[model samples]
Target: MDFQKRHALIKEWMREAASMILASFQEELTVEVKTHRNDLVTNMDKAIELFLIKKIQQSFPSERIMGEEGFGNQFQDLKGTVWILDPIDGTLNFVKQKRNFAIMLAVYHDGIGQMGYIYDVIEKELYWGMKDQGAFCNEEKLPVVEDVSLKEGLVAINSGMFATNRYHTTEMGLASSGVRMVGSAGIETVHVASGRLAAYLSYSLCPWDIAAGKVIAEEVGLVYKKLNGEAVDLLNNNGIIVATPKAYQEILTEYLLKK
Candidate 1:
């Protein structure tokens, strides 16, 4: 399919998926904890995943899917078109605050990202990108990331970064103008995409947590790198950071790697 045709279909799928999510929001959702209290699941997540899977199967049957909730296909290779989906990227925030959660999707062809979406359901905000088409927030397009000093930048990192001995995020925090942890990678990605923060640091994240956001950020001229200052693999989970080029250079050179 042409890029325009595919995108129109994708947007339609996203809208249908969004309506399902809104319907779920109005009821008393059944909730379950996954690995810990901080990791959560809800009926909404499952239902939304199912809704998306059905659409993909009916509309694009050949595509493989990797979904957070196991409602989509499980594939070992990315040789063909693949969809990476997170029905609700911040289940904990969804269960607790009923906001800060997002439905994210990314489409890859032979391991290259072709299109991506991040939908903030409560705020009705959507960020989307097509590899060369640039990134959009609602109807407003995002501009390229800018160069700035650490003192002029605010980063969104995981709160655990400060609480743990890992990566010296506490020291990084000390050097930057400030730090904020919103507990959701999707939300953090939104901030970085819009230049609300120059960077976002997360030590542990799956593909679903960062795939769509990575594409959008990259389209808007930000760098999506592994915490070690390497290019991010769209298919793997790792220590990931999204940042403006200058802030990223500074963080890697000055603040990281402390034991």
Candidate 2:
């Protein structure tokens, strides 16, 4: 497969989709709750999903797509080329703060991630990775992150993880220099991938939430695993932890796996 060509095409689709999202911000969003009030779906999300789905089907009819807004393929198996799309990650942040949200997309072939893209929409920064080609932010290549220990580096966690003490993450946070809770999983994972945060722990994420970030994290030598230290299953609603290798082992052994 021509990965470079595919990468370029995906980026083009993302750029146009981004424009659509930005335009929606100017208009009043028609919002609806998905499973709960906090779980939001706007007309914009559906629109972007449909747009990207159409583009992908037209370009690669044989490939399957999994999207957050349910506008793509319904297949559960990642047998062939599969595209995972999260048109607007952090919908609450988008609706309330109008920032901190991201657009995430990833491609996996036979369950192996081939490429990933996370665009911080308001920041206008794109973080991307190609399997063995390395990861990048904008035009600059991102260096492999050194293994910063828990004591020396900050950590990112969400409220649910802290409230429930999921995987004993509250204790894990105490071991770190500090804790940050960003509403957007994409942005938080980018911080880990970029070395700005030593670890990021989140409870209960769908594949689309971490799909793009996982590829970027792995490219930079960050460890991506289930919070319980199990291998991540892309099809499951798994609790996840992305951290430097050293921190990951420590968190897993001392905190998550201690009990």
Candidate 3:
């Protein structure tokens, strides 16, 4: 596969998606509840997801797509080239703050992540990575994050988890320098990848929520794993932790695992 060509195409598609999302701010959105009041879906989310899926289908007709908006294929296994997409990662943020949201996409080939992208539309920051080629923020290459311990750096925890003290998350936050809640998994994951945050812990995240971030974060030497210190299953929802190696070890051994 010509990864360079695909990468270029993905960037183009993401930029187009971003433009669509930004333009929607001028218009009233048709927002609806999905699953619950807090869970949301908007016209822009569906539109963007469809737009990206169309682009991928046109370019790579053979690839399968699994999207958050239910516009893509359904599969039980990751046997071939697969695209994972979350058109608008933080819908509530988009609706309320109109910022802090992101568009995330990832590509996996036979269960291995081949490429990942997380685009912060408001900031125009595009974070991407290709397998073995390294990760980048727009044109700038990202370096490995510092191996900071949990107490040495700030962490981001899911608000609900921290508030509820799920898995001793409140204690974990107390152990860290501080705790943050960015709401968007992609944004939080990139923060960890870029050394802006020591770690990100989420009690629940779907495949699309973390897939792109996982690839990019792993490239810069961040550990992506389930809360139990196991590999994340890309086909299912998970409780996730993405952090620098030292932070990961400390969080797992000292906080999460402590009885």
lDDT of 3 by residue, 114-157 (tens): 99999999999999999998999999999988999999999999
Better of 1 and 2 by lDDT: 2
Model 2, position 115, has a per-residue lDDT of: 94
Cα lDDT tens digits for candidate 2, 1-259: 6898888898898889889989887799998999988889899888888898898899889999999988787876889899999999999998988899999999999999999999998898999999999999988999999888999999998888788887787888888999998799999999898889999988889999989999999999999998888888988788899999899889889988887
RMSD for each model, in Å, please? 1.4, 1.0, 0.7
TM of each candidate vs. truth? 0.95, 0.97, 0.99
How much is 87 displaced in model 1, in angstroms?
0.5
Number of the top TM-score candidate: 3
Q: Which 10 residues in a row give candidate 1 its minimum summed lDDT? A: 250-259
**Reference-based lDDT, residue 179, model 2:** 92
Off by over 4 Å in 2: none
Q: List the residue pairs that clash in candidate 2.
A: none
Candidate 3: deviation at residue 155, Å? 0.3
- lDDT comparing candidate 2 with the true structure: 0.90
